[model samples]
Target: MKVGVLVLAFILAFFAESLPLGPLYAQLHPDFVALLILYWALSSSQVLSYFGIWLIGLVQDLVLGDLPGSQAISLVLMLALLYGWISRVRHLPSWEQLFFVFFLLLAQCLSAWLWHAWVGPIRWHSSLLLGPALGAALWPLLTYLLDQLQKHWPRRKTP
Candidate 1:
């Protein structure tokens, strides 16, 4: 069922995102959870509610040991910004959608960076952009794979 697949995808993404890559690699690693959220948010059917996304972000914050609610705010804001034009975005070519994902990830990253800069010590560097860049680069592949998964999933029964 769609819901089952959705839950599975999110679980896998959470674990993947939480992997212990080295310090440099970790910074460069794409945020798999955020990427999955974006994919589902832009899908033909709205797969995740706003609160669900917020909860996921909060979980990410807890997992990453960041301040609670920082990621929640960022992800909810990102979904709010995209919700208005999701239909239009769903119709875009995969390449164009990649650009959108890049901007979304960039914004998410910048928002977190700003939060850290405000309340905690964080080194400002050029490499902060790498994670978003890599996320964008991986968008097409993630989309394709998820699309296939969704297509193969059994349709939910209508009551």
Candidate 2:
């Protein structure tokens, strides 16, 4: 049931991201999938491993029609970073956690930009910063909602 909810949330976020919201809005739109992946990595790393993140990235790449492994690689890197620091982060206050999440989002955005620059045109824009900023802004609301959903999830029986 937890897995189902996570997958459903990811799919919804993917579609929400793909919505047409004019040129500027689209450019400034946050990477909801990436943010959710980070949240899961922090909140439920045991359940959502690097392999799951890679698969999510691949799905995202397919949906966005990008280079095959681009998002997969980026997400894997994000997962790796989260895995290394998750223990320390778990004990932080909400404000500190938000600060850390912002950096994570920044790193993900930077990696995606670098990957795109390597494979395509050398375009640089302020919108890259906007993505992470928006992601951090939304983190608190997302965390609360997901926490509520998790709390209400049916528990598994012990054998």
Candidate 3:
């Protein structure tokens, strides 16, 4: 049942992440799949863990037509960063959460940029830069929606 819920979430993220915004928007776009996965993974024990994150990231890499494990590494980094912050913060409101999401968008973009620099130049990649900016702007609404999903569907624990 947990696996089924995660699969559903991944499907949703794929669509959310694949939205064909203008060329300028792709780079800055928040990784909905990653974001959702992280949010649920952190908030719910039923959701995927580090291993699941890696698998999703690898799928994302394939979806974007990049080498495998790029997103896996990025997911690892994002998870680590999230865990670090979770330990420090308490009673975070919507605004602060939005800020954190935005910050993470930038981190994802930076990871992609470095991948390009190290591996080879990926042409026509500027939109991803804009993605974080726009993604930040959209964070509040997205988080709200996801939170609601959590509340409504609320994955059931199975032992």
Candidate 4:
């Protein structure tokens, strides 16, 4: 069932991105999958690893038509930070649980900005920050839903 959850997560990410954006503007383009990936990496490191993060980031890069390694590196760093913090917590709260994801999303945005820094004439659109901010803001909802799913779903029996 872990595999099933991973597959579902990827599918959600795929469809979330596959949809068309509106003509108005996109400074707030949310990284739906990245948030989900970070949540699981922090909460369930045994399930989502650096390789998993990199793989999903690669898929996101391909689908979004961005540089191949940017998201991969972004995700790896996010997971590593989360993992380090998680190991240090002996009595972590659900709120604290969500906070790490929020932090990672922010880092990803900063990373994205830094990536664009190398490229000339950066848009410097204040709106670009919206995506990660919104992603971080949505962490509580995402965490609740994920918790419910894990609680109700019957996972495969471990050996």
Best prediction by lDDT: 1
* lDDT (Cα, tens digit) per residue for candidate 4, span 1-159: 256666787788778766777632345766788877766665664645578678878888898777767777787777677667667541466566555556777788778667767764576766666777677677678777877777777867879
Ranking by TM-score: 1, 2, 4, 3
Model 1, residue 98: what's the lDDT? 86
Cα lDDT listed for each candidate:
0.83, 0.81, 0.68, 0.70
Return whichever of 2 and 4 wins on TM-score: 2
- Model 4 lDDT vs. the true structure? 0.70
Candidate 4, residue 13: CA error in Å? 1.7
Q: Go through the candidates in order and give the C-alpha RMSD of each one to the true structure.
A: 2.0, 2.1, 3.5, 2.9
Error of 2 at 137 (Å): 1.0
Per-model TM values vs. the true structure: 0.90, 0.89, 0.77, 0.81
- Candidate 2: count of backbone clashes, pairs at least 3 residues apart or interchain: 0
lDDT of each residue in 1-159, candidate 2, tens digit only: 278678778878999877877888777888899888877777764756678788888998888787788788888887778778888987776557887788888888788778888888868889989888888888888888888888887887899
* Clashing pairs in model 2, backbone N/Cα/C closer than 3 A: none
Q: Model 3, 76-126: lDDT tens per residue?
A: 777767777764432476566767766776687677567767787666555
Please provide, for model 1 over 1-159, each residue's C-alpha lDDT reduced to its tens digit, 9 standing for 90 to 100: 267877899889878877887788778988888888888777746456789888989999988888888788788877776776687788997778888888888888888888788887889887779999999999998988898998998886889
